[model samples]
Target chain A: MDVLVYIEHLNGKIADVSFELLGKGRELANALGGKLDAALIDANSDLATQLGSADHVVCAVDASFAQFSPMAYKNALAAMVKERAPRVVLIGNTSMGMDLAAGVSAATGIPLIAYANHIAVRDGAVVATAMVYGGKLFAEAEPEGEQVIISALAGSFSADAGKGEGAPIVEIFAAPTGGAGTQFKQLIQPEAADVDITKQDILVSVGRGIQNADNLEVVQELADALGGALSASRPVVDNGWLPKARQVGKSGVSVKPKLYFAVGISGAPEHIEGMKDAATIIAINSDPNAPIFEVADYGIAADLFDIVPALTERIKSG
Target chain B: MNVVVCMRQVPDLVEELEINDAGNDLNREYLKYVVNEFDEWALEQALLLKEAHGGTVTAIGLDLPEMDNALFTALAKGADAAKKIEGDFANGVSSHTAAKLFAGALQAMPYDLILTGVQSAEDLDGQVGVLLATYLGLPHVTVVTGVEVSGIQATVRKEYAGGMMSEFTVSLPAVLGIQAAKQAPRYAPVSKVRAMMKEKKIEGLSSSDGAASSGIKVRRMFKPEGGQRAEMIEGDADAIAERVVSILKERGLVK
Candidate 1:
């Protein structure tokens, strides 16, 4: 195998981003005429067995690898990379992925390209594409050396179940010790969302332009009238205006509701990827050129303040 | 305590940006520059730490024409000192090179903690702080939202996906990739910044050794591939609301 994908697991379940990378890694491996391999640290054997996309699965099931200790993962992966010498390694551009990728890249002196949206093997080297200028532009990077590791952005690629007939060859690798500088204390999950926005059929999403916490009532009224849940962009959640669970974006809930009303959301690429799968997306923003409008099914260039109340009234009366 | 904040002047993407004719980089001639957003948060964290712990916060950036204003603004916002590296960091391809530049500059300074943004808006790599930690041989954490220093070890809260948070007790002389400040970054008015510009001097450090060339190279940069155009809706408030209601009905979203 000449290409390796790190399988990320959280809360005893495989992360969706890991499967997305596997799909992408399978493509890159095919492009290079190499087998695809998956790396899992402290992952369940059953989870590794299901990664049919990979030709082989390497599991470091040490107790130390149970939780995400950057040094522990870095040391283990670095050891594997040292032994495997794969041409390219792919990781998800998530919290764990970023930490692991950076540590391994630094430890092994391998070049790393982060937030890669696309990857291709050209002339025997991985050509990774990443977004820049806050997703307004794209740049293709080619690592100057034989080895390259990239963190592919979440939602950039679709996850696919690859066709592999036989059980993948699972190699159990021993985890390395000697990480004393940092320790994993605990994982504090957000309190269960009062309303799981993912299950809602309709989502009324607000963004920074919602202005203030007091103004949320107007948007909520629309959501209430439509019999939908109220959601928000990162700013609204970060501002403590909304619970984190009601946030929609790459880092928030991925909602594919029947109708998504984006009120005042400028639609950053991160935010767009979350609800881009909505059956109907209606964006109301004051900025005519907001990127949300570009992806919206129906984009109205007006202040959401005026539109939300009017929309709420109409939904109630009509 | 001495704290260093890695600051960067990035192209203000709110303004229009054009790819240079070379096809691999931005056209610098027309783009306006401002402090990278996350780096501003990192600076605020550093300032807040200085306020609470009675330490000096020194901000450093690559020597760019527009960085003087950013450093001066930081000074007005309570940064104790500022420094700019002398080199062509614009052409640097990866965080590795930038981290090397920073490491080279910091080798002589005594510091208890170093901070930088989790990532840059332009590169979005989130690699600099980690790489800097590696080069400096220090413990490091990324995407940190909260920080508290008690003696030598600091307890920090790191944010993960799905709103998960992890608390870590990292030893001092560490690097943190600050995701956000405990509070919003303080606003420094242009007049206050101008006053600081007259009162402060950003120490210039020559990177004569030059940043080691990065292994990552840009092949090309272009706009995203085209997709279907969105349908624009035009009308007054009531008219648009009606349109939305009708569309919802058409989609069976409303009875």
Candidate 2:
């Protein structure tokens, strides 16, 4: 009943998603009456104290780890798993996590179930719940073998910083001594948008339903009337109707605006992953059953063609 | 350069889906299948690479009733050759099983690189490409947006979280999970697809080799609990606008 959680860090601080995994990992370990251990590729002092919930913190310090190299991370994690043979391993469902998990699972032949929302020990086996059919359905899965790895979907669990007063035992591990075929070059940050929608409290975000490029003017007019910034879904950015900077989705800027207006946006789970934290979300779509309505505060099931002009006029008159 | 892309036919999710009586899988009664979007990206990337660098692009998929459309579409979209493996994966096979089948069939062919979608919406598992790479003992990367191939080496742009990207140089005989193809998958007119169906032959491979157990099983599937339900505001266009304006005013989002 040993559990291991992989800790991800950026600029020496642990990513929030890693803390969420730690919280869930601690719960799973306690349920199975097992010890929880945290595995980190980089050595960061500030991160080690926050992992007090874990009985041991295994750190593999290497200069290569300053930037994420999937091969390097996979080599280190696979070695750690081989030594500890933890029953369950938890990783954050970030891009780096998915990349590393794929290689590790293949290299070790361990069972992996990604996009897990809930994990538990049932009947002496690790059971995890994951989404299928684009978040329309959920499946509960169990590993056929003794060992399993589960990637925690972001924002699924509450992150706990831990309550223990004493620092956890830290064990330093050696980096893998092999040629990493892939080299990590510089990380290219997206060019700054003329307007950083992340700083905007009110946003008028458009999606595929905007129909055509010419129709964007109406959405723009609405944004102007509402005193909000113009934003968009991935499709808009992909279609080159808007800058990539204004895109709101898993691959775009995560926004916490106060009032978010979703116009003609069908809520894909990837898009929802970014804007779900907004204070108030109002979604407008013709389809009543589009997933956007499920998370929106106000769901308007009407054509934007009919709704936009009237809404814009009202704000203008007032 | 020789490129291979693995495409999968999935239930078109735009249409309504119902739970089967077994309560563990989707009802196949009303489901219409189509090539997965991500795999379409993979196919397009392979074809684009073939166009840029002189190579033959081969597309493969498991045999299904809806598979012919996918294969012929690949041909119409400029795939040099198409293959359909004779297998009944209708009920749905694990990514591990599919990867093994692909790897087994690929062992006979000369290939410089392999590609597939990052994950399928149907299974939501992103392991097939990685498993295939592992089975073939090749270096691999996932969520690739761009790839520049040169002889035995490749430079790829891999997307990470928060819109950050990293450029990597990997040796050839590698696998990549295409997050987005360099170009949107070309739309072939149905007439072209029909013409290709009659003019070109799709090589069928029978792969009866048993795959190693996937070591994971689904216990059950159920609809997730509703997270938040929207407040329905039904009215005429003008009435709705008034309601929305008042709400916005209350929220202090308007001037």
> After superposition, which runs of candidate 2 have C-alpha atoms over 4 Å from their true positions?
A43-50, A122-124, A161-165, A211-214
| A1-318 per-residue lDDT for model 1 (tens digits) | 378999888768888888888888888888888889999887346677678778899888776666777666777898888788888899988877877788788778888888787888777778888877767678899888788889888888887644345578898877676554677778888778899999999999999898889999998999999999899997787667898888898668688998899998977777877888898899988876567866788888888878889888999998
Residue clash pairs of candidate 2: none
**Best by TM-score, which number?**
2
Please report the candidate that would top DockQ against the real structure.
2
Candidate 2, residues A70-114, lDDT tens digits: the string is: 677778898998888888889887777877676677778887888
Q: Which stretches of candidate 1 lie over 4 Å from their true place?
A: A43-47, A122-125, A162-165, A286-289, A302-310, A313-317, B90-93, B124-126, B235-239
Clash number for each model: 0, 0
Q: In terms of docking quality, how is candidate 1 classified?
A: medium
Q: Which ten residues in a row have the lowest lDDT in candidate 1 chain A?
A: A158-167
